[model samples]
Target: MDINQTTESYLLNAIQNKRLSHTYMFEGDTLETLRRYGMFFALNIFGDTPRNQSLLVEGNHPDFYYLHTDENSIKKEAVGELMHVMNNKPTESEYKVYIIEAFDKLTPQAENSLLKFLEEPPEKTIAILLTIDKSNILPTIHSRAQHVHIKGQSSDRLKELEYLSEADLQTLDVLSLNAQHIKDTGENFTKLRSAAAEFSSKWINGHSLVLLDIKPMLDLCAERRDYSLLLQLIDGYVRQALHSKLKLDIFEPFKEGVKVDNIIGVNHLTNMLDEIEQANKMIQFNVHPMLAFEGMVIISKG
Candidate 1:
């Protein structure tokens, strides 16, 4: 299983040209991916010598150190440990390397500490800050690091328009029926999210989705490989609509049926888009997945 070659080529060019930056920010959706990119680059740069692995396991690599919170590991004193290491001369390799994962989780105090370090980092020392949540990152930190983004694919949605112009009576009727159903249901956020997930899942699994259900998922979709997050969100909207519909009388315009509070109109839908965009930004910045995920639920409910 290999990743797309863009990242590999970028790193290869940097290494080959000997133009490695003092810090690199690697962002993506998959943990395994983030880990591999860091480890692979670390090994390629400093892993060849026997001392490399030995120092890594011993937690005293002169050339490389990883700061993270893990099993029996220190809580993320990332900036401090990194600064400490930078103060020392490299005992083993040609360059000092710091690989920091989840940079978005750095507390405010830590971010401040990091900002200072970034302001005047030691020479020949390289740092990589990895995150999926870019939303909450301090502007200073963002400005300090050169960013690299890795986009994944959506394996959920299927071939939606099976023959748009075709006039097969049964098929045409089915599509028309589906289209009308979506318009009839309305704008319920929670219901929409769930319906979208269910519909997409069914479609991808070789089952038919009610066209009404499929429409709203497409109404506001993600561009990259963020289809997973987008679909789950569609589910949230549906449920929200269901809960709110009891008090409101306006539920037309979803084009996909979702229950919504009477107050939830086009403006609410527009607001929801803003919120989701923020959530996606959070993911890109390396905010905790749970933080971003739960935030979506809350936003939909609101």
Candidate 2:
């Protein structure tokens, strides 16, 4: 994946501040891309001059070491070899940096062996481990390393769209839609998203005449697809509020935030989703969109 502004700013800040961690775990995207970025970061650490970059690219940097395995797993022997080399002081730069590609492929024995090295890394030594999946790494190793997740192509595109959040992309993902879909239907999506936020906010605030608010949403549904999208958006909002009530980290796309009082329990939120589902199903049966949506609000209120 291409580097986006977030990644660029993050790397720039870290490099400028010299806030280098002893060990870092880079996760996400392809292994090759992570490795390339990992090397780029390592080069920046020493001084990203053209000469330094060339040395690293040509594998001629005395202070920079790269390890990769073609086998199914990285063996203990490979890690032991790394330990031997890391023990020496830097030949050229003030810091010695080593990058291990496919870190998740390290064998359990290798991981255990590496943990000792991480516990007391050689003075002025840094380790950069690249992995596609973090779950395979031991918790002990994870605890000692700072993690950086590289966003994929889709995520990069979503980030470029100023109006959408990761949570919003996830909602579209559930519907088998994507960033392109949002771009094509930007206006319509914005309307539905706004309406959902407003309606859910009023409902959760215990507005006495909140049922009347459905008219605006019903008015927006010019087609069956629009009506279905509206119901899904509202369902998403309520689900977000329910997650918030339970103190879950589930992402809420609405920037204003979702709130739930003590009175509204999980049952209420579940029933609301059910009502939306029923209303959405009505569209397939040729039910009048306004009547069906109005019925949903009334039932949800009751």
Candidate 3:
């Protein structure tokens, strides 16, 4: 189940026939993928051309607005600001488009505010909400927007997997066995994956002092504002370590530098994963990146 030709055709036809929905929900495995599709949809609405498409991709279009959770949940105030913006006429195009990333992270109050706007969207204004988990979105909002599920083929995924280092691929293999997927292949993500592997090896070897080793990585994550990917990488390593201890052959490559016996027990790993999730939630709510990373480090130490 991937974003095949059929999905692409349907969306294009909808735009050409002037049947595009006023509000849409794009659900997918990765934010980057969702964003790609969202930009496609937006460019089509504005009459797709090389220049306009490039502007949309670079986020330079005046009529296009992109929003995401800021340090925390999408607050009510942000929604209010969006509503105000939407109420105005399009600045340079026939339609104004708003794309919100991590829509499920919107606070309850923000959802209420959004619901009102969705109930009666301004004419020629389009709203695109992107989320990895559709179930977390409010039912009322769900009813108002058309849902689009974006899936990627394993074969295509493997192609992107080529960009990863041997070690990163091994970590990804472990995650795949557990039904987890990482679709990013950017250089920054590759570097983060390597850092995660090194950090996991040291942490499992009972070298709490290795905190110094990860400080630079933490700073990089903060600089890039990529807390989500950082957490995902850490989560992958923990899961891989757990599989290694269980003598899972699929995780063998990842076991090279890991001390199998020194790895935390399954129970502790489970708890640590839970704590990491909580830390991610805190970040969604807008906690400082350094604070969130420090908190996760402290949890791992314990």
User: What are the lDDT scores of the predictions, listed in order?
Assistant: 0.56, 0.77, 0.73
Which has the greatest TM-score?
3
lDDT for each residue of candidate 1 in 73-170, tens digit (9 for 90 to 100): 22336568678978787777778888887676677787877778888888878888877556668887778777888542211011232333332212
TM-score of 2: 0.53
lDDT of 3 by residue, 141-211 (tens): 89988999876343433555576676666655544321123442256666676777777666655565766
Which runs in model 3 stand beyond 4 Å of their true positions? Answer: 1-3, 152-302
Candidate 2 Cα deviation (angstroms), residue 286: 42
Question: Each candidate: RMSD to true structure?
Answer: 14.7, 13.1, 9.3
Over 149-208, each residue of candidate 2 has an lDDT whose tens digit, in order, gives 874454444554567655566666443333433554665776767877788777766678
Q: After TM-score superposition, what is the CA distance of residue 199 in candidate 2 from its true location, in Å?
A: 31
Candidate 1 residues lying further than 4 Å off, grouped into runs, are 1-3, 47-60, 70-78, 152-193, 197-302
Error at 297, model 2, angstroms: 24
Ranking by lDDT: 2, 3, 1
Better of 1 and 3 by TM-score: 3
For every model shown, what is its TM-score relative to the native structure?
A: 0.52, 0.53, 0.54
